[model samples]
Target: MRKKKCTMSIPTIIECFQMGMTSNEIALQANVTARYINSVLQQHNVERQPHSSWLRRYTVNENYFKTWSASMAYVLGFFAADGCLPKDLQLVSFSQKDPKILEDIREELQSTHPIKTNPRTGVHLLNISSKIMKEDLMKLHGMSPKKSTILEFPYVPEEYLSHFVRGFFDGDGNINYKKRTVSFVGGSQTFMEHLKKRLERYSFEPFIVSKEKYHRLFLSGRKTVYHFGQWIYKDKNLYIERKHLEFNREKLPPDQIKDRPFKAHKSAIEARKLKLLYYYNLYRDFPEACKSANIGINTFYRWISTDEEFQLKFNSICNEKKI
Candidate 1:
């Protein structure tokens, strides 16, 4: 009897090949002869590896996350910010707009897993489908399938804390050279608070502001931003290039550095006051404004009575609305 001809598309055949399926396996699944599958793979310049070799095509150090090293801490931190674990899959995936960072991470992890691009968003994705890796991430690092909102700061060793923070910063933090600010945004309030506490140990007075669904920890002004750059990049070689370059650019003049006496800093206080004023203007009611701004009613009243500048600004805004 004659064999059925290969009916699978070229892309499907290539995909199966890339997925570590042997030609015979693809042929069997597609209901075609093995020779037909081999020809299709050859036409696409895809090599036909033995079944055992194909199974080992994508190799990684499964024990990479088990020990605490600079690379391990950094990868863990980055994962906490950007990695995702599917509820039904034994996989951990990372998506980044910059493929360079993903490439760096893959190299650091010694992973040969292919990095695929999302055509729709032009994002690069690296998915490691290993049960051991997934289990280690969950059991060792306290990672969950959907960990954004409930993520707690992991216990990174003191010596490797900077590396961990830098990794997390590379994933979720931003630096504004023009504004002279460094900020971290995270979905978990607990995580942000813990991060803020850790940064405080380095003399960074970061302030946390609650957003609608997440929290933002911010360090503003020239002195803090410059020092932050120095702190996170100290003795660290693994970092996102663009951000590192931006941070290493010319330092601002000493005269431009403002003194920060309070923990919240002058800029943060001004930002909070502005946020309160914005809410007040939106609602035109003091109590409602306080609620929306996430500030206590007592705090609003105290700001009005204690700070002459804030009080004047509030009065001006209220007068402008009346007119």
Candidate 2:
């Protein structure tokens, strides 16, 4: 009698082959002959990679965090801001809105793990599952699960400290054009204080302010912000593209830039007041408008009371809405 053909799915066979399983191993799982497994892979245009290539595919430099190179420092800082390590898993994961930084980080870590995207949020994530890597991050770097509120700044060597700060900035910082400010937000008050102290060492007058849920380190004024840009990006190898472009725009002449006046800080405040007023007009609700404008309601009322122009504009908006 003729032998019945194997009923295993072709995709499953191909998956096994792609996962570096030998034909015999796949055959054993699929209950088919080794030749049948090979036939399915061949039919699906799956060429066999050498064993060495397979080894390289799944392996990463587990000791990558042990040294203090610029790349390592930057990655560590970025991880401190955007990465996560679960207490129960041997996994370290990073999520970013920009996938390019994630790709750079993967190369820096010598990891071949796939970068996956969340369909719902369009955020890219890279997960590396290695016990050694996770432990190294915890023991050497003081990173812990649920570290957002209590994380302490890690000990970065003096030479690579700028790179580390730049990495953290790329992850949790903002460059405001209208305000001509560079600000960093962190969940840990102590962490923000540490960062503020470091900035002071460079003669920068960074100050910390408490927000509702976090702390902010602010470096305002065009000259100060520009100097900060220079300091962080002096020897940069990796950075978020959009933020880099934003800082580069500061190089333009004062007349060419429309965001802020060259020497008048009042223009920036006026611009912010006008923006908040505009948001209020659109929403017709003070709290909602404040939320949209990312300002506190107390600040809004202060602006209304202190700035006659802003108060008049707000009154006009409210009157129009009443009509």
Candidate 3:
């Protein structure tokens, strides 16, 4: 009597592989031995990809991208600042002038990939080829391979939004006390617009200005910069110290901060509305605007609820001016 052959389909095996299942695991699910599963996969011309040494050395945690985590926020910020996704390849890369930054990012990600340095360019790069990560980033954050002009604002977790923003600011933002500006520069117009909208939520009046090929999100005025610096630097653990140090009030000239024309009223109801308008035009965040205007949180809420004209003006300004 002739014995029947194992009946698992090639498509099933491929699906299991795509899901990051090992051959043995796929075999268990299919009620077959591991060898049979590998044979089936091989017969279908699906060669198992070789794992990188870095990947082999470390236990890859796929759960990191399942939600908005502190590590994830930091990675996104680093990506926005100095990382690149090659459209033609499966690799995601981070390049930095400081190798330590790359090392910190690698540690934060728990990535096992070895850092590569280009002597000519004087930049250290950490490259990773991770399909699961790519999919997660694309699905969760809409990050595509050729993500330049197409980059959009991520749906960040509310509690960790500041962390993610800090990562990006650390990567690409600059604090110029002399110029009285804290700015972020990027090549994507879409990214710039999204950043402007996000800043509005924080009451930050970020101005978008085009310079050469890239766009700049600029928060000017000492009060505005000080408030922004405070918000972003609230937790220094996740930032580049050199960049964070520039925002230290004591380190900067007190005369410059004092001479600034921003005056706050004690009641801060009407003042909040005026500041909101100022920030709205600049496309800044609401909370930061409140802080900058010295409006108490409770007062801001009461004014918003009781003041009808204030509401109308706020909406009107946002509709007419915000980009």
- Residue-wise lDDT of candidate 3 within 84-156, one digit each (tens)? 7655344567888778877887777777777877667888888766767767777877777767666787888
TM-score for all predictions? 0.68, 0.65, 0.61
- Candidate 2 structure quality by residue, lDDT tens digits, 52-157: 1352367678999988898898999999999999554467889999999999999988888888786789999887767888999999999999999999988988
Q: Model 1: clashing residue pairs?
A: none
Root-mean-square deviation of candidate 1: 8.6
The lDDT of each candidate is: 0.80, 0.79, 0.69
Top candidate (lDDT):
1
Task: Give one digit per residue, the lDDT tens place, for model 1 in 1-323.
Answer: 22345556678778666655667767877778878877777877875556424335688888888899988888999999989986644567888898999999999889988888977899888987677889999998889988999998888999999999999999999987766678889899899989988998988867665657978888766677888888888888678999998887745575676645433466655666766776676578888877766788877788889899889878987897899
Each prediction's RMSD over C-alphas, in Å, is 8.6, 10.5, 12.8
Question: Which model, 2 or 3, shows the larger TM-score?
Answer: 2
Evaluate residue 131 in candidate 2 and report its C-alpha lDDT on the 0 to 100 scale: 81
Query: Which segments of candidate 3 are over 4 A away from where they belong?
Result: 1-59, 249-259, 262-323
Best TM-score among the predictions, by candidate number:
1
